[model samples]
Target chain A: MDAIETNSLGRRFGDVNAVESLDLTVQKGEIYGFLGPNGAGKSTTINMLLGFTPPSSGSGTVLGYDLEHESVAIRQSVGVLPEDFGVYGRLTARKHVRFAIETKGADDDPDDLLGRVELADVADRTAGGFSTGMKQRLALAMALAGNPDLLILDEPSSGLDPNGAREMRAIIREENERGTTVFFSSHVMEQVEAICDRVGIMRDGRLIAEDAIDSLKDRFDADSRLVFTLDTVADDIVPALETMNGVTDINADGNDVSVVVADASRKAPVIEAVGASGVTIKDIRIDDSSLEDLFATLTTGERPTSRHAEENAANTTQLIREADQ
Target chain B: MSWVHVARKDFADALRSKLLWVLSALMILVVAGISAIPQLLYIPGQGPAPGFDDGMSFMFTWMTMMVSIIGLVVGYRAIVGERESGSIRFLLGLPNSRRDVVVGKVLGRATVVAVPTVIGFLVGAVVILALYDGFAVTDYIGLLVFALVIGLVYVSVAVAVSASVNTRAKAVGGVLGIYLIFDLLWWTVPMAIYWLLERELPGSTDLPAWYVLVERLGIWEPLGILSGTLVDIAGVETVSTADRLAGDVPFFLETWFAWVIVIAWVAIPLGIGYYRFNRAVMS
Candidate 1:
């Protein structure tokens, strides 16, 4: 069974359609990455899945339970770390973890959960004085309670240092290995690319693209560049390389020749073409288009004008006018 | 069961709050101070003297107001404050439903207010017993129960306001508005009604209907219900303020009915608030 499935699920805040026609599906035991820019409705979609916000249209199910009518059952089976959540400031880390355990009706040890998040030493200290990173860890520990079947994390790496983020990724990996389906939203491309099995990119409250990371790059026609340092630059090397299949943007800078290869399959042919030119190859370096670049290219492209966006803008303007009055 | 967890967490959190502690301490001090009034005035108090009853009655009157104020302070931020701070997400992220949150918050705040009220009453009872020989245990218990219920009523009011409003500032403003209307302006309501009726019907000298309306309106306010109940429970014929009104007390003004009114004050607002709260969007 799919861990989560939504059929054109949508939510509107007045005229602002925060999430629209969001048809998404995540398979069991897979780590699905939800990527989007700020205000792109990533959080809104997550909120709808968790039943924190009701959808204006469409239907969904989480772990075979209806999103609207059986939210409590879904919540019981799934763990969440919301994007904008805050801990009870006066409660200690131990108490927060214990509260989650009790709420989930789980047999997990609070101390063990805190230790997993590296919060064992300060478990007794009130969370009010905790740094943002510590609080994030505490929240993660709370989410880990009950050995949840599904974990939905919104910006889990937010407010974490590089080390802390690495630890968080490790925890996700461990949980995934334990057969927990993970759905997490993040603006951090490196973490998502490193961990996500499949990713869905959102733009203006719609799922713009959804596929495996490599396939997404391929679908966008983002090529990998191969740079070669040559012992000698033959006069015809540039033209010959350009004429080769799957090679484009061939350029020569003194002893270095650079060309964009459409995919890994084109790597061998491009190298063979260079050798055929009699230019002795010294060092070869291949640079693939990072997910970051692909993300920028995807989100920054000319967007289709949405009625919701226009209505939202009009509503905002009206609000401003009222405020001025 | 989930609500029990939520309530326990909220109770623990409230207990650690410096503001709650300060308010509770102040309430205890006020009760003790009020109980020591006769001693402060250097009056010899023993047996069933009028002075002893007067002091106890006076303490009950002010204690109701203080407990109501404390209840408002304890509950004004119960739900809306969490929503404003984004902490409600953490709460709802668990298995608990929105109903669990509302119920748990109300119960938690009620406990916070109830504990200090009990402490104040117990301390005041000890002082009253030590100073006056003929203090009735049943009357003291009655006063304690009445005071506690009054506290819960205001807590319900504050929680209702918190649940109904979206913003913390708005919730605080709403509760304060309730405080002003019920605590400060309640007395004026009856007088204002009388004045308007007198002006509207100038020829009618005996406005018995208006008097009955005022008495009924008085039942809605916690202090008024508390005073009337104290009068019945303590077996006092008539309070000084009411003695000048020159009329028999209405049936609704009886003490048993006052208990029902106080209980209704706790229930009606809570029902409306929770109804609205269940449908509220957490965002």
Candidate 2:
């Protein structure tokens, strides 16, 4: 059974359509990543799912409960770490967790949850003086209070340091492994690419793409991006690389020219072509377009907004046929 | 119940909030100190505050002022502060309803403000009773209950304002503006109407409509109800012209119209606030 299912969920504020006719199905025990720009209605979709805001039209079911009629029941079974996580400063970390657990009528040790979040050391200290990251962790611990089946996290890493961001990703992965249906949203591509099992990309209040990370890369013709750091000067390489049979696109700054080669074998001939032109190559890197590249491609409107990226990326999956001798 | 759990958390949070505590303490000190001044700087003949016949007279004013100040300070932030801090989303994300949150906030804030008001009233009442040689059990009990209800009403109105507004500063201003406007009108309107009826119409035997309206306003005034009830209960014979005009309207506002007006203020705002809060998208 799907852990979460939204059928044509829509929301509007005055004339601005925050989310329109959005459909989603998240199965149990899978991590679903929601990727979008700052105002692509990503947060609005989550709010409607949680029943914080009633849908302008359509309906949904979370944990088998009606989105509108059974919102309280749905809320009870889900854990949410909002984008801006805030806790009452007067309560200690442990107390905050305990309060949340008690509120949910759940039986879980606050200590265990806080410890998992690495906040047990400051368990007794009031949250008033806590740093942003610490507050975020405390909020996470509170969300985990009832051992909820589904965890909805929005922008979980926006305010964290690099190490903190990595730690949050690890926690999310750990939770997913433990049978939690995770719906995580973020504008940061790296975090979602690293942790999400499947991703849904939203743009302009509509979901433009949804698939596994690999599938999105395969379908979008975006898996491999050709990057080069060269020693010699060759301004014509930019235009020459663009005109190559296998290269779909070319972007160059000075001697460093990157060609999006459709096939991996084209890499050697492209380098040879540069070398034959008396341009020495110092370094060459084939960087696969992770979900980030696909997201940028889809939302930046460089290409038409369609599900075609899925088919294109997958069909071109084979390693590029090398250039002929 | 979930509401109690919410209330407990509110209390815990309020205690931890230095701003709230400092404001409460400052209000208590100012009210208590100002109340005690008449005793310290008394004249031998203008004699014991004209009609200082009872503990209710003094305790009512002290507690009412404190409650209003508390309502303005702590209650004003109940919902708006959560919205401003972006914490309302987290709280609302739980299984609780908007009604439950409103009830919990009002109860929690009332408890906080009531405790201090009760304590201050008792201390000030005892001092006044000892000095004036008057005390009544009815007066004490009535004032305590009145203070609690008034505090809750203020909190309810303030919370509603908080929920509707997006910022804490706006909520504060809204509450203060509301209180100041009512308080000013509570006094000015009645007196103006009384003057017009007395001067403009010579043979008007009955009270003017506008005067009646102003007098009715006194019944619900947070400051007026306590003072008026306490005065009535204290068995004071007659109020002086200045004290009667300056003090009695708030007194009347407290006793006569206090409960009905206060209830309306709380109920209407809370209904609207809940509607807004239920649909608020936590960002």
Error of 2 at B73 (Å): 2.1
Q: Which ten residues in a row have the lowest lDDT in candidate 1 chain A?
A: A307-316
True-vs-predicted CA distance for residue B282, candidate 2, Å: 3.7
For model 2, the docking class works out as: acceptable
* Fnat computed for model 1: 0.82
Cα deviation at B1, candidate 1, in Å, is 2.9
Docking class of 1: medium
DockQ of each: 0.74, 0.46
Instruction: Tell how far residue A97 is off in model 1, in angstroms.
Output: 0.7
- How far out, in Å, is residue A136 in model 1? 1.0
lDDT of 1 by residue, B74-118 (tens): 899999888888889888899988879888888898888888878
In candidate 1, how many Å is residue B30 off?
2.2
| Cα error of candidate 2 at position A156, Å | 1.2
A1-325, model 2: which lDDT tens digit per residue? 6888999899998999999998898889889989888999999998888877789999999999998898888879999887765667677888888888988999999999999999989999988899888888888888787989999887888789989999998888888888888998988778888878888878888877778877665654433466678886546667656666777656677777766666666777777776776667798876654445456655655542443333223323231111001
